[model samples]
Target: MPKSYLITGGAGFIGLTFTKMMLKETDAQITVLDNLTYASRPLEIEALKKNGRFRFIKGDIYEKEDIEKVFYQK
Candidate 1:
């Protein structure tokens, strides 16, 4: 099976930095779920998207539907 990771609040500084580290160190598919309330780093996100293994999802973790959307990928 392929490796995958779901990172919450990844648009923020610490999370985004960690995401980049993961991208460099691991071959896992990294997905980020961030509400973008605290911070909105569109440029960084866009840069990360250039990588095929990186994905960004904008949604609140408190919402059940939003959480479901992450695992219910088609």
Candidate 2:
């Protein structure tokens, strides 16, 4: 089974690179949990978005509801 990755700061340089590397390796699902803060650029994540395995969520870590929405209740 493919693994799920929750990558914080995923829109930044290192994070974005890691996201791309993961996608290139296989069809693993990745959730980019970035606030899109001053340092982060939405455009940086655009290419990853083109991959079906990549998902971007515009949210802050402090927000509980946003975090909850991403996970399925099992």
Tens-digit per-residue lDDT, 1-74, candidate 1: 66999999999998999999999999999999998874768789989999999989889899998899899963
Flag regions of model 2 displaced more than 4 Å: 72-74
lDDT of 1: 0.91
State in Å the error of residue 65, model 2: 1.0
Q: Which pairs clash in the backbone of model 1?
A: none
**lDDT values for all models:** 0.91, 0.81
TM-score of each: 0.90, 0.85
* Candidate 1 wrongly placed segments (more than 4 Å): none
Tens digits of lDDT, candidate 2, 1-74: 98888888889888888888988886789998888878887886886678788788877778997787568422
Q: Write down the RMSD of candidate 2 (Cα, Å).
A: 2.4
lDDT of 2: 0.81
- Model 1 is weakest, by summed lDDT over 10 consecutive residues, at 34-43
